[model samples]
Target: MPATDVVSWLATAYLSGMNDELLGDIINDVQHQGDTSEAMYAVAPHLLALSQKSSGKMALLMLIHAGLISASSQSQIAVPCPADLATEFQATNNLGRSMVLAQLAHNHEFDDFKYLIAALAGFSGHGRFGRLIEGFDLYQDQFHHALLDTPIDDER
Candidate 1:
């Protein structure tokens, strides 16, 4: 992707309303068609664009958790969260917050982290039925981090 295209994508993605249907399509593509070499790369720019905001981050994380890409692959293609996001989140609450941040920061393993993603997706941008959008931002990253620390086998 060219720098100009990236800039354009970022603006458009950030400004647009959350599109669950679009996200679902992208997720399906990554989950089903990800084996193809070109598919992931083709979908990466959109995923990268969505990663800029909390709601989009939820979608991006869903892709990661669903085995869309390896950690190294994601690092190569997707945008990294600002370094300060980690530090800032970690400092807020030790055990809970650190675990969430760690999970997201190290989202290479494929596991059943979908519930967390779904929860965020459900409440992202707006609460149930699009009612409460204000406090959603407060728990955004913590929600992002919630499944970050899970062990792939400890499905307890």
Candidate 2:
């Protein structure tokens, strides 16, 4: 199976679970996904650059999925952040974190560009060309995030 396929499967699994704690397990995943020379030497810098404006949690995920940006694997080479990518991912809602995680499941495509685009279509209810996120009303209730562990529940 392709990496994207694996990730799409995993994403379905995660969405089925639908909780905040699920975020943490995935957060750890971002920190340790790649450990190759190709990862270390070629990809680390780009990851770091993408993470510049991200929050700590968001940055970590971008780092893990963008390629590699670990201290042990910091490349002397600089990966240029392109000035002309027509698509600009901004974290207006949940950001692109989930989309990035979805990318990791597939080792086939360099990233989950396809899934990200699809999910984004679902999120905002619009395709990259302009179609809105479909099925928005059907699954809009906390996205089932409410089923997750709560602090009040921990008191029990």
Q: Give lDDT tens digits, candidate 2, residues 1-156.
A: 123433443354334532235433433343343222322222333334445544444554444443322222222342322343212322221343454455446433322343344334423423222112111111322222222442222223
Worst 10 residues of 1 by lDDT: 126-135
Query: Which regions in candidate 2 have their CA more than 4 angstroms from the true location?
Result: 1-34, 63-70, 74-156
lDDT of 1 at 53: 46
- Evaluate residue 61 in candidate 2 and report its C-alpha lDDT on the 0 to 100 scale: 48
Regions of model 1 farther than 4 Å from truth: 1-15, 30-34, 56-67, 71-156
Candidate 1, position 59, lDDT: 49
Cα lDDT of model 1 by residue, 82-113, tens digit = 35443432232222223334455645333324
Backbone clashes in model 1, listed as residue pairs: 100-145, 103-148
Q: Model 1 lDDT vs. the true structure?
A: 0.36
C-alpha TM-score for every candidate: 0.32, 0.21
